[model samples]
Target: MLNLFKKKEKFILPVSGDCIPMEKVNDPVFSQKMMGDGFAIIPSDKTIYSPFSGEVSVLFPTKHAIGIKSDAGVEVLIHVGIDTVSLKGEGFESFVQQGDKIAQGDKLIDVDFDLIKQKGFDPVVVIIFTNNSIKIEEKLHHGEHHEKLSISIK
Candidate 1:
C-alpha cells in the first residue's frame, strides 16, 4: 500500500523534564487525548523549544500556547501550562511570532513556572497533534533530552 512509504516524523522533548504519557497529564483535554494523542512534560526549566522544524501557525494571544505546522504538514500544539492562559500572558514570554520558521531546539517561549504555581496553575507542558491524526510510534526515554519521539500517520 502507498502508506508503506510514508515518512515518519521525529520530535524531541521541547523542554527539559521527564517525558510522560498523555494520559498522565492532569488535564482532561490532554489526559483524555481530546486534543489529539501526544506526550506531556513536567518541565524543570523555563525555556521551551521547537520540537521539530516548522512554521509557527498560531501563537495564542496569552502566550501560553503555540501551534506549529511542520514541513511535512503535521500541526503541533504546544500548551505551556494548565490554566495558565488565565494569567493573560503574565509570566510568559514568546520568542517567535506567528508565521515564523523555526528549527528543532529553537527557543519558543520562556515561562515563569514559579509565577504559574503562585497563581495556582500546573506548569505541565502539553504537546498534541492539532490537525492530523497520527500515532506516537515511540517515546523518548525518561529524563532524556535531545532525543526523538518518533511518530507516524495512521
Candidate 2:
C-alpha cells in the first residue's frame, strides 16, 4: 500500500502559551504524577488553544479535556489537570465541539485557573498522543515561565 511510503509525522504545540516540563513533578512538594505523555507548566490563567490543525475529535462531557485529530493523523489529548475532569465542566467552558475544524492557536477551551487552583488542582496542561504506536519527536523548551513551545516528527 502507498501508506508504507508515508513519512513519519510530527505534532507541535497547538497554542502559544506557557509550558512546563513533566520531570519537575518528581519533587514530592509538587505532589503530582505525570498522568500522560507530554509535560507543560502553565504559569497564567487564560484560554487553552489548539496545538495543531485538525478537527475537534472528542470533547469530554466534563469539559475538562479535549481531543483533536491533526491533519497528519496525529491524535492529541489535552487534559487541563489531574482529576479536574471530575468537576464535570464546572467553572469550565468549551469553545469548540466535536467535528469542528480547528487550526493551531485556535481557542478551544477556557479554564478558570483560579477555580482550578482553589479546587486544589494544578493547572499543568498535558499534551499527549492517543495512539502511542506512531513515531513522534518531542521538543521541550527549558526554563520557568516560557511561552512558545515546539514539537515535531523524528
Candidate 3:
C-alpha cells in the first residue's frame, strides 16, 4: 500500500561519466543548487543524452545548454560546463531542437572536449531540476551512467 502511494520517479544520468556531488562542480550557482537540486558529471565521453522522456523546452542559442520538461512534470536543465556559454557554442553540437520529444538515453548533444580545454574551460555537465517544488531523494554523492534517482512530488 505504501509503495502504491509513492510518487517518486527515477531520473537517469544523461552522460556516460563519473557522477559527482554537485559541490565538486566549482561553480557556486551549481554547487549551491541555486538553479535547482541535481548532480554534475566529469564526463568520459563527448556525448550528452536525455535523462528522461520529455519535451525539449529550451536549447540555448549558444548551444551550451538545454532544458526539458519531463512527462512526469519535472523541469530539467543540462548545462555543459562552467561559464562555457562564453565559448558561444564553439565546441558543441546539439542533436535535438526545442519542442522535440525525447526519451531517456536519447543522444542530445556532442561536445569537443579538446576545444573546451584549449579555450580554458572546465567541462562539467550539470543536471538540475529548476523547479524546487519537488523533493529530490538521495544525496547522489556518486553514481554510474543512467543510474536511477528518485524524485518525489510534494
Best by TM-score: 1
Candidate 3's residue-wise lDDT over 13-62, tens digit each?
77767777777788998898788777788888999988778899999999
Worst 10 residues of 3 by lDDT: 1-10
Best of the candidates, lDDT = 1
lDDT score, residue 12, model 1? Answer: 67
Structure candidate 3, residue pairs in collision: none
Clashes per model (N, Cα, C within 3 A)? 0, 6, 0
Runs in model 2 deviating more than 4 A are 1-18, 25-36, 132-143
lDDT of 1 by residue, 73-116 (tens): 87889999998878999999999999999998899999999999
Off by over 4 Å in 1: 1-5, 138-148
Evaluated at residue 104, the lDDT of candidate 2 is 69
Residue 133 shift from truth in candidate 3, angstroms: 4.8
lDDT of 2 at 21: 59
Q: What is the lDDT of candidate 2?
A: 0.64
What's the best-to-worst order under lDDT? 1, 3, 2
lDDT by residue (tens digit), candidate 2, 1-154:
0021143443445444566555554333232432344555564656787766789999999988898887877676787776787788887888889999988678888888789889888767666655543222344455554443334322
lDDT of each: 0.81, 0.64, 0.79
> How good is model 2 by TM-score?
0.73
